[model samples]
Target: MMGEAARERRQFWWFMLFALLVIGAGIGLRAPWPADEPRFVLVARQMWESGQWLFPHRGSELYSDKPPLYFWLLGASYALVRQWNIAFLLPSLLAALGTLTLTYDFARRSWNHRVGLWAAAAVLFSFQFVYQAKRAQIDPTVVFFITVGVYGIGRHVLLGPNWRWYWLGCFAAGLGVISKGVGFIALLALLPYALMRWRGWNGLSEPAPRGAGKWWLGGASFLLAIALWFVPMLVTALVSGDPEHRAYLNDLLYRQTATRYVSAWHHHAPWWYFIKVILTQWLPFVVFLPWLLGPWRQAWRQRDARVWWPLAWLLLVLLFFSASPGKRDMYILPALPALAWAAASFMPALVQRRGLRWALWVFSMLLGVGLLAVGLAALFGNPGYEARLVAERGLEVGSGALWLWRVLALMGALIVIAGIVCRLRHVLLFTALGVAVTWLGYGFGIAPLLDGESSSRDLMHEAREQAGADTVIGLVNWREQQLLQAVGPVTEFGFKQPEDEQWRRGIAWLQAEPTQRVLLSQDVAMPDCVDRGQIHPLGAANRRSWLLVDAQAVAGCR
Candidate 1:
């Protein structure tokens, strides 16, 4: 009894530590959520301010790419922060924590506490998971629901056939669908559960009575949950005769789903793409994946109920992402908990294997050397050369690569040294510690630098100040439209627009403007009035050349 209690206590602490590490690392690796996060926050803030729940606003224009759940969450967060900045990322942080909890729960129920701990650790430290958690994007929400669905299914399957758990699974699936459209429901989570149950007779072997009534109840609950959102959306679309509603429906249902299956926008990769992403993103944990596969095959061969279920879950997820035409690096976040489970389940066996310690030590050493070399190079390297290289090659290096390099190098060195110590003592605890430290350093130290550079808050503030409150803002070209929209509403005039024709009429219209301030791109061909000393360059934002035109003097050009 004492031994069992001790084991339970140890597992509890380990799980807690795992949760803390994941959350802490995520918090530390703070990058301003890129691309989607800023837009999501802006729209949500607008929603809060305008009280427009149906139409997502980007400045004065309607922006419709996603559903309302993420925006609603961000809007609430924005109120708390008293600003629509990084605070919007709170949802992602919460989702990440939820993912950790779900992962632990699922692993513990299916396998053992050790596997649970490892799975939790993997979810926390995996590169993509950590990255997504820190960003204010929809992916973390998707991950959260997917995690919940997986855990719910795992519980239902492991604890005999329970309609209650299946209902919970349906609810989770509904949340997942609302979070990121139908893909989470149709592709990632539900299909896996169905395949696992169909192939593995583990569900039938359960001690609980399995009847047709239970299945019908479970199915009805799932359908009802899904209808709650989509049915409302459909009804709303029908009531509103707005052309924009039709556009949104087509974009979400057709373009995003049907087009994604056949065409690639931002996430087009070859079939082997997921393989590389998994290896790199999951890192050292991926090394133990082969052990899981061997056991997986053996379990299926022997028709073992315990092993086939989880293995089936893992395979379904892997196959779904692999077969999908639209693929991104972070698409593997849903599969991570399972991989972690597989890796952790075999960790003890792997630790006992001969030469495993040497291999770990060598891997740690290599990582250390690589990080050190990169850090030194970045620290001493010329900024001009770096910029030139980026410009020439269009390479995407992390903005804070130099800082990240130094931190990663130090962490890697510590891991190598720790691994060497563990090698002599043959302690798996040391190996775990080393990896944890390294992951912590990578997330916390490296993430901030990257985020600082990416954040547009400061830039927006400067632009607003330079342009002044009363300035009638206009884009120099179409390319600047998105950037200007992010800052605030601006009068956009294309080269062929009637507004451009009026502006081309000369200085009289410019001088009659309220603020007499015109923002023009350096790349655009300036009007004759600009060269005639009618415009003065106030200041630059984003290092892009922008000229402030004086409306008073432009009147003489007419």
Candidate 2:
């Protein structure tokens, strides 16, 4: 018979293969989620259609709020197949795959193959990782660069003092910066390792020959990478006197970092925000905290750099992001890999102790039972629940809800079986399987019906039919999302009240243009300088929800 190690190797490869297929298949299913996905896809669509690769434009205006790296990838994807949902999500999916590969490589090289696989699987199946990686958002790419940078730097420190690895790390950091403003923060993970290396501890001792020179060269490499995009952008802006470019440069350097960090415009949360997110959103892994305590105690006893590096980095990230007033769940995505590694310290116990494995399975089964209860509740709980869902999310308690429950039940049953079996192979395999099934159910079975109401595709299409496609559409007292999903070039305008300066400017702009259709929020009032003759009120989805106005009624009121 093959040895246990040999068997685990086989299982790991198969599990990875299964995960790969599942994640890829997930891309083929599901529509976009709003407030993020549609906006991103629309921006890329606009960029692709405009052929203006340098500047990102949404509808009629330049959009420079985010750096253009993800947009470039997204626009490129849109150009390839012209499919928004899957195409826009491609970068994140690929980035996630890369991250998994690197995590596996790092863990395998540092520890055993089993440990490495466990570490990767911990991240791959992580709730946040799966959720974020499947979306067309900035977080996945951000996480990828940050993780890759840490992995690269780690090779130089732990394995050997290789110049190339150091340079690679620097390059990754540069890419991370371009990917998201705060990506450079990922390098902070290397600090504890560097400090440990200086002391020559954790099986690492003696300075790398010419390490100081490598540091300068690495910094130079980073600057060169930054110059690839930044310098040209600045020069182009200067030459063309593009006001948008000026704003982009300013935001890129200042407001996005310093101003935004100190006092934010939105997503304002206290220091405890990330703490709550870490506890609630990043559960199961966080459940392994007791498992982690042992490793930390061991590492502290041994003064081991391997353990200290990830732990210290976690501290730094928590402190850094916690200090910022502006916070969101996705903001801390880059820190998850470290958490996984730190958590995977418990994998050593799983390797040797069958009792511990049984305990873990018991935990899994208990968690599964709770999930099963919730899933069952979702299906048959209360008539009020279904009514509330329809009222709030426009979801019906139907086959989709049932399919989700079925998946959850299967998940629970499998966990209970794993617990009963109480074998290491069974535990790892079933845990990974549970994540796979959940995502599969979401991606294939449940998401279609669920997304129908969540997505704005139908509403946008129906409104266009009412307003006529040929008519120029502008939004006043409406969300930018409405314009994003609309059929044509829908102009966006209006903010607070009619008397507000920004709102007045929007009215003036709408009046100046030959707009034939206008979508307004129900609460907003019509302006006085207007032609009352051209205004027509179309039926609305909800009263006081939105107002569809025919701006073609704009008589020569001017």
In TM-score terms, candidate 2 sits at: 0.85
* Span of ten consecutive residues with least summed lDDT in model 2: 538-547
Checking candidate 1 for backbone clashes, the offending pairs are 507-554, 511-551
TM-score of each: 0.80, 0.85
The whole-model C-alpha lDDT of candidate 1 against the native structure comes to 0.61
Specify the highest-lDDT model's number.
2
